[model samples]
Target: MKKIIVLFSLALLSFSAQAQEIKWMSFSEAIAAQKKVAKPIFMDVYTDWCGPCKMLDRNTFSDPGVVSHINQNYYAVKFNAEGTEEINFNGKKFTNPNFDPNRKGRNAMHEFTGFLRVPGYPSMIVIDEKGSVKKTMVGYKTPEQLRADI
Candidate 1:
């Protein structure tokens, strides 16, 4: 079982590496690259405790077709809304000072959670090439569903 899990993870990683190189860029990199690119942006808002987020990573985002489409049409940014990382966007800094580092789970909501206005886990915010919100989605989504959205 352990071997299977490891193999599965490795396979997913390899597929992710090949299927779509455009994914989860650092804040600064995303901002810089996206400014010059003509495609839209898909911001994946998630928390470690959210089961659906992991599922999306394992299933939906890993799909070769979905990955290809996203890579061609969007810049994917994985945002751990409850993470500890400090981020700056559009000349504004964002962080969560009250986030409990010692806590056991992914409950540390980032300051941008409120700013982006997403109210749920595994939320996907689609931004146009002009950096405007095109759509917002919460919970799990299949590759087919994502295709439909695009």
Candidate 2:
């Protein structure tokens, strides 16, 4: 009985100590959430085939400080630059009409990505509560650097 209790306590402690992840929302969801709570949007624009984008997710974004800071201060959003999902931003509906499903690597950029004029993958776009772009950081950023930028 004592052994079972110890194992249960250990499992509970491990679960409580697990890493926290950012509560990522879609662009439209972030916009809607802004109306209710009025938080700036921290949009991560990435592509599936981008190496640096994956690195950002694994190294910087997974950091506890980065995750906490973003969740508390901003409405964290993850946008796929080459995805087919239609997004409505700035009173305009955007889509990747030219997206090739058969393509394995890089597909056509989403219309919203073009509208934002994103320089490349792993672009971190900060949008004000009013839905306007505040800052755009293009490239991989460490937790310290990202914390400083936001």
Candidate 3:
């Protein structure tokens, strides 16, 4: 019983120590934070039904090194490509005009997604503090690859 308790305690401590979470903010919040801190914006454009996007979340984003680097260097934003939420970006309002609430699998893409010109799922957009796009990376990238790209 004592041995089991010690092992359980060790497991708890290990889990806590490895819990390095990235501070993912909304698009508006990321923009707001950029204005204050002058850091570049890193936006993760994903759809709820995208498999690669889910993989990115489960793999690359979950890596501690990637989380630490992103948190320190950029204002991270998670934007749902097919979301219905209205967003005000660069003095313009964007929304998903064709969104169907009852639709399953795939839905209408958000206006902001079009504005960013995201070609596919699991896209990563990097914008400078001046609100200009710096880079647009498509598809899935490992933590090391993401760090190298950024």
58-106 per-residue lDDT for model 3 (tens digits): 9999998899899999999899999977899889999999999999989
Tens-place lDDT per residue, model 1, 84-115, is 67787767899988898778875657898888
The whole-model C-alpha lDDT of candidate 2 against the native structure comes to 0.93
What is the Cα-based TM-score of model 1?
0.80
Report how far residue 39 has shifted in candidate 3, in Å: 0.5
Q: Model 2, 3-119: lDDT tens per residue?
A: 999999999987765657899988889989998999999999999999999999999999889999999999999999999888987778999999999999999989999899999
For residue 137, what is the lDDT in candidate 2?
99
Candidate 2 ranges beyond 4 A from true positions: 1-11
- Regarding lDDT, does 1 or 3 come out ahead? 3
Worst 10 residues of 1 by lDDT: 19-28
Error of 3 at 55 (Å): 0.5
Query: For this target, which candidate reaches the highest TM-score against the unseen true structure?
Result: 2
RMSD list, candidates in order: 6.8, 1.8, 2.3
